[model samples]
Target: MKNRNDKQGNLPPEIPHKKRFIIFLSVFAFLSVAVLIRYAVLMLRPADTENTGNTKPFVERGPILDRNGRILALQTRLGNITVWRPDIIDRDVLSRDLAPILQIPAETIDARIESSSADFIYLKKQVEQSTLREIENLKAEGRLRGVGVEAIVGRIYPEKRLASQIIGFVGNENNNGLAGIEYALESELSPASVKAKGGSGNQVFLTIDSNVQHILEEIGERIRRESRAEAVMFMAMDPRTGDILGSASLPNFDPNDINSSDDISRMDRPAIWAYEPGSVFKVFSMSALMESGSVNSGTVFVCDGHYERISNRGERVVINCLGAHGRVTIRDIIIKSCNAGAAYAADRLGADAFNELLQNYGFGARTGAGNPGETVGYLSPTSRWSERSKPTIAMGQEIAVSALQMVQAASAVANDGVLVPPRIVSRIVSPKGETIRSYEAPEGRGQSRRILKAETARAMRSYMVDVTSDIGTGWRANIRDLSLAVKTGTAQLIDPKTNAYSPTDFIASCIALLPAESPSLILYLAIIKPKGDSYLGGRIAAPPIREAAEALVDYLGIPRGRNPQISHPGSVSLPLPISPVVDAVVPNLEGYSKRELLPMLLREDLHIEISGDGWVRRQAPPPGSPLNSDTVIILELE
Candidate 1:
């Protein structure tokens, strides 16, 4: 025992066990205090931590604008009314109070709260600013404890039903695009930068001019209503750049009121709907045949009302014609839209060769125009062709096509042999209007594909010009003093139940090129299953084409022929009317040329209807008239 005590004393001075235990406790307590202080420092600090320094605030979705910079679709700050069940002091009172402000039934709100499985339920979504203000006011007064308005960015279409299918609608929950250009360019339109530096998505500018679109819609609506057609698609394009100027599909729905519309009304018919185009396709067929050296301008065929073909199976195949035309040349085939003559011309080429030529014209494939649900339009391959397929396809039977495809195919003739693929989106730009990306067809992709020889295209245009003459099928499409090349089609609709062409139902369609020698515009109109006394394309569709051309000619300032130049006095200086008026009044627009008032046409706030072409001859609002949103500044030019 002595040895153990002596060894322990030699090691160190002995302290009380209680003192040693207190020392350890004090050390631990000091460390705990230090840790608590550190935690408190971290907790009390601002959220500018190293990790959070790079975090970005949420950004709003960008706007979709027309080619003229008119807002088609834009995001608005919308509030969604939500209910927290646990926080609700009085569910009955909350529901009753919220009902009228939300434009909802009180009983319905009450029923929703009672039936809800979730503690939190959305009472109403997309609450207007006025409505949200009311709810917010009540909440400020402690009237609504559980009822909260959560802020959300929502899409709003200011133009309503105008270009609805082209702009498309987003999902209610995630705001993802469901159709049209929205769906096709989702990444470009959505605020994807929220994950990075946080900025608005790139703005998409379409090639469609709102004024031109309005004109087409006005005409298409009239055609649909007067003809009692099932549907209508009227589209216009610049043949040079393939920029779609206007596209209007009837039975259009307002994107703001999408829930009230169905899929049929929402369909982008010009891009998505595919049907068998009749004689209008003859132009393409003849072009293909002519390009292959199978037919020429001088080549002639005899027609006895219908085309007769002998199949390998010893079957008689017949494709009827609109008229007998005793003898027809390639020019007559196009001018008269003679199906028998077209079939005879097609017979000169082999099956594979004919199909290949048509395929080169952007048939049997998507035009890559950036439409989401665009159909390839059923053009069967040579392998799938029957014995009667050659002649049948020649006269625009059996093969199906879309209005977009028709426009794209016709560009070859209009562009003097170059095929320009249709492009709806002109460019994608940043929120600040900086060009993010410019869109154009890639090389080796029909950007410069000469689908026809220059001579062949010229010849084709010349033949199509005759179609607008008094003797041709498209004579009704002619405009006085303006050279127009036109093609009219009246195709029979196929009955789904019968799997054959419907006897009563027909599609009346027309395609026209203005200033036939050097076309600047191509207009296409199709009225499907038109119910009327007359279903001929010339009678029903051609007149609309003429009306559209006449308006477009004056609106676009296309030269109606060479006019004598009138010299203005050099001493007389007049300021160009840029802004309408400082007070939003209709200024003195008289004596100003049509070009002077053009800038006013682009204003979203003003609706100016200009008729005729020279200097301003008359004004509706008069000088210094207060211009409101509904004010129509009518300018008549001479």
Candidate 2:
């Protein structure tokens, strides 16, 4: 009994019901506060933690623009039309309604859905906005059940096929670049996050001018079709700044329909295709010879239709020429394109010195113009030279060079002996038009290195001008009022089976620098494997140079040298004398020549309307009236 009473007392009085409830409330309040604090910490953390995993949030890619701010390639919203077979009530009705909008036959759409192994199938991909709208309207009207549009980010080339090879195309799966500038600058064009460092997915502006590119493409296509050539590559560049204005490769593809094009049609030939440059190489060879002190303007070499050299092993090496240009100086060699003269001049230098000189001209290196698949071309070291290698190379054989290399090398001549590295991209700009980086070097300042002496360049240019003169090989390139320094080449292709020059296959090409004395523009064009009546460079390739030069001279507003003065007869006599206006009244301008109306034309108050050329034959208001604000002085001249 005592123990029971003591134990009950030891419990120390039972807590009040209100106090116990208060204790429970306190413990719950602490837990609630802790949870609130934890949530706040999570909300304050930086978003970078979310990307710690393998997945990343997609960001909008930037656009590709031309130098003039023309949109070439851009990110666009396209929809993939999808269908769920389980949701479909009537397949024929759905296909019929979507056929016209999708530009596909109803039967084709039915077949695609019928042969599907899964419940869902894509009706079409990359559907245009206009077509997507039509489908959406039908869906909203409850016409096509189970049909849906899955929104996706896609690329569209606004210019279509204009510069397809340069712009390239994006892959369907991940929207990654597959080729061209799209692939070359993928990281810059596509960003991982909105807050990416350096610059956000910025706009890539190319040096290519759409207007000039259009002109080159138009001309290249014409030449390709007419000459029946395998392909054609044309390019234009600002020789001083090394900005490639236009690079056109014929047989181009429409990036919008990339699957329709093959490998050959999609190649950027100007920067990638390497071939023997034929007589055009003579320009560089001659320049190298002059720079090495091996030959001068006055040095003369005899050309008896062929160049013959005897090796120490009693081997006779003979190189044939186009013709016998007798007693020819270096100038004559350039004008006539004499292989014998170029070979004899090259004979004066050692193989190592000649190879070094040629390398300095950018023959064996890539121009780095930003095109994918660019080739460095081929130029073996002097140690690999055979007995006839020197003379053969001198005459434009046993060496291969890309079109870009040729353009880069010619820039030295056009820029007065300085070699400027070519650049295709002009700048990287933000989406808001902020300049992030500039690729164009300031005028007269860039990565320029001297390749030839100033005087040597001038001499070479002068000799090249003679090539467009009456007696030279490139005379067909001459323009009426424009002065152009031109070089033409016709190289025979090597047959794979024979391993020798092919008699039927040839590459005809021409290069021109307008305003020979102070050149500003350089244009190069080549027609590969021209199967025409005449494959000679002078006959086929030179004419296109003249044609392009004329268009460029007009488009670029380049000065067309000096025009011949023409004597004009004095002003013709009018039928009647003009009367002077007094007190703000209309004057009798009838029968007065335009020259006599010079003062009246400058009056701000009078609205003068004059038509035709000779003199005022008829005057409105009968030639005598007070001038008013609404009165237009209409003088009909004959």
Candidate 3:
């Protein structure tokens, strides 16, 4: 409302140019101070924002050990080299220094440091300690840019190829578990650290005994070499508890370099592959008969080498008998491996009862042993059975079974009619050596089912022992000091295209229980498609059984039948000095039977080659020369 001159007068007059500049500078200084105070407060306060990116490296993984506390697998510290590209002072100099130590191309290192996009890049992982030391020396010289090393856990196997399939292996990234126990118990064995910030690590304890595993692998290798078979699988278990002591499959791959192996060789054959078990299956057929109360061990049947079909399907199935066994009891049938006898028994016990008994024995079913890729063998339903199915199945054809199933089923018989579920993992121990989890032996099949009486098992065991004695098919499996009860099987492989048996290919198998009366150990060995030799199980598989039994007896320290009398150092020889048998030239014992050669060998106190069936064709230590008592004589048979 006032006059314009009066309102203008209320405001100060315009300053000189220099004075105005000072005023402007004063305002800018105040604004700058305010900005600086805000920035300082922001920097001084703790960051509320989460890091979102974690930098601390991995914690160590624990060990995988066998039942004997032997290290099967372990994790060791390894060095990984990484670079901070932005921090790299001289890319060329760094490349020059690191190229030789890291064994990487110099160009690769130079390119990595020159790249503007990467904040951090890995140069090398799992570098050995020695290589890491070399890299550190370059870093001290100020020529290795921003390269830094972090310790990482690397998986390692002490026993290279032993039990490779069963133990499995880890992978490239962080050495995480990939297969076998590594895959099965990944979470439990690799737990997050207690800090809840890194990888969890713990020890996994397996039921496998490393010593037993070594023995099994050694014997399996021997069998594969001797039989020249396509593949061989051997497994041993504690019959009382179904604890697998050892499992070995030939053509094994070293887990340390698993990438070099084929997928087939990497598979755990004993648990994965299924086959048509031959005469060895007679035990189950016989058990089915006894379980149904239709027959006993004394049940007898006449065997004329073949069984004619009574059903109207016009299916005439031939039951091949090893020899003409006359009227034979169930025990005799099993011991003699008479196919006709088994067919008769299956016919006597109807299909329904037979199948039920098989089911009760845990056949045609998976054992659920917690192994990866376990096969539940094929067992056709009752409705699907053909007219010849009964006899064919009784004679060990048609039904397919995994080696693990055979072992588990036999465990029932060995455990006195109570089946115990097999297990590979014994327990899980924490990193602190405290037990985190313990696996107890699982109970047998069903609560109400009883497959056979204790007396029946004992009687069957006796008959089984007879099979390894003079009169039965498994006589070749006899051990020197231990009693071996074994059954031999030679299964014909069916050609899918022809829908018929292949003449040349056969699966030779032998299953034995040592100390036949009360078996503590049960062993099963199978040689698939053996070549360049006799394919009979008695010839190819029995010898391995004997070797395994002998090795096991020594390993377990089982008291020998008769301990050798210890001689005192100063003890004198008998008054009448026993005349030492004069060394004689080795004899041509080819084509001679055990009976024919026994007396001669005893008279000369000579060691003899007495393996396989039939007469010998070749002999070691040519005949008619002075032979020392310590000399071993080899015999060849045609």
Candidate 4:
């Protein structure tokens, strides 16, 4: 070294300078490596960012409509109030501001904000648009912190409880189908909506006619009021096609608020509940005999109003009838509703043959009507049948059937022995308005079993008509201008504990086909546990059938009376009586009490105006005229 002291005093040597440069290069390399490693780590990490900030919240579901294009169920957008705890600036202030507006307690808001476990929470769900707008105004002014709105889809029912049991309701989470048509057509009714845009969806079409449904409901309500029944179920269908036109079960609830209703209220009774069909089963019994080639419509039997059987166990079963008929033909049996005659026919057909007929009619099997909770009614197996079973079943005792099954079976008679399946949904359309699928009327699905001949059906229909005419038990069911064929049934409900009929408890029912010659509509009515005067089907159920028929005839515009040109010359013509003419001064019944005006109007034969419950207030054709007996005066009251 030239001189260590001299080099130290002046500057660093050449070798020391080279060493410092090496140290600088090494530090630069280490820094570059560290930066590269950090870059790789960030690229490899999973993207788990919260989706709370996503613009669209929920996807829309499909719409369900009735046959006439009336919307039954649909989806609509609703707002929800959400909160971000971390962004909240003044928790105490926010709590007080939102408590009353959101209907939430102040303490609840405070606790939610203090919860470090949750990044966000909901303040309220499905708030109305108006209410949400008010909250948004507050949020914009900074009075509320971390609060935002999200749009969500919810199910809506326009007609409330009109067809709740058929249309069904939806669940909250994701708007899934819950019951009725919703459950039956879940996949179709709940199709995926357009990609996250929350747009409208596909449409599902049903076969129910809302007008016919209204008529049925009105008739059922009237029956409930008149009979004071525990419950009433009325159903009408095209018996040839198995297309249910109208169906109603009393004590119905609105599906929009289905959660508030009891489970029993939601149960669809027509497809779910099974009951003894009473004498209505006699139609099937008579058909079974005719189908077996063992009996004809002219076949006669004696009925002493009781049927007795000696069982294999030495037990005697005594079955009582409604009345005594000395000798009755098959037609007469149907007319009088003779239980003994029906039991005798069952005895002639024998147990195995009769059971086969019952099974053929879909009594023990599901109707496959695409309904939820369909019941397979009671029918004893061939091996388990007892001697008493035959007689009891003959009079509609030992077997049970759902209302749907009864209607489906009757469809055979109405369709010339061709059995068709029943369905509610008519077609399903995609969101783009393309038809995806359609459900046709129930056909036998390749099963070639024929129950009755066309001729037999015609004969049976003729006999059923007599049941509604002057000489039958169901005379009350007669419609003035329409030919109605109906059968009335009054079955005694057996107490399960005693295995005997209860005197006071009865199930009154009627099954009818209108325009008997070429029936288009078939109706069935059942009133359970009616409380008022009579328990007979004629008195309790027949009038409802008449009312329903009258409404339907007026609605459908079915031509009244047969072709006049085809009438027989010697047909027993009844003379129409003409009322006597009255010429008198019209009475000023206005402002007069109904109690005071009744006697004066009746004595003078002058038309009177009566309005309010208390008294008449105003009248037309004022107080005097040579009043035409046929003219009716107008009245107004307060």
Judged by TM-score, which candidate is best?
2
| lDDT for each residue of candidate 3 in 1-638, tens digit (9 for 90 to 100) | 87786777654346466688999999999999999997887677655322325545556666788998998887776778998877877778788888888777999878766774778888777666778788778778766768888766677777888888888888885446788888777776665543222455778888899898889899888878877888998999988767899999888998766767888788899888889999888877787677677887568788776666556766565667777677888878877788888888888877887898788778888887767888988998989998888888988899999998898878767666766667788888877778878876564333223467765666567567667766677878886556666899999999888989998899999999766645788999999988865999887888889888888878976534421111222221221222333244665555554323423433436566655434566777767656886888877644
- TM per candidate: 0.72, 0.76, 0.71, 0.70
lDDT of 1: 0.83
Clashes of 2: 0
In model 1, pairs of residues that clash are none
Candidate 2: tens digits of C-alpha lDDT, residues 545-578: 9988899878987766331211123112223333
lDDT of 4 by residue, 1-638 (tens): 57877767865458788888999999999999999997777677654323435645445678888888888887776677888877888889889998888878999878877875787887777666667878879977867878888766667787887767888788876467778988777766654532322354567888788888888888887887888887788998887667787878776788766657987667788888898989887877787678787678667788887777666789886777878876777777788888877777667776788788778888998887767888999998868877778767867887889989888888777766766666677788877778878775455344334677766666677677778756677888887556776889998788888888887888899999777655778899998888866989988899889988888877876544531111122121212111232255555556644323322333334444545443456777777755786667666644
RMSD to the true structure for each prediction, in A, is 13.9, 14.4, 14.0, 14.5
User: Cα deviation of 15 in candidate 4 (Å)?
Assistant: 24
> Which parts of model 4 have CA positions greater than 4 angstroms off?
1-57, 79-151, 192-201, 311-315, 443-449, 496-499, 562-638
Error of 2 at 222 (Å): 1.9
Task: Quote model 2's TM-score.
Answer: 0.76
User: What is the Cα-based TM-score of model 3?
Assistant: 0.71
- Which residue pairs collide in model 3, if any? 191-200, 192-200, 585-625, 591-616, 617-636
Native-vs-model 4 lDDT? 0.74
Better of 3 and 4 by lDDT: 3
In model 3, the worst 10-residue window by lDDT is: 563-572
The candidate, 1 or 4, that scores higher on TM-score is 1
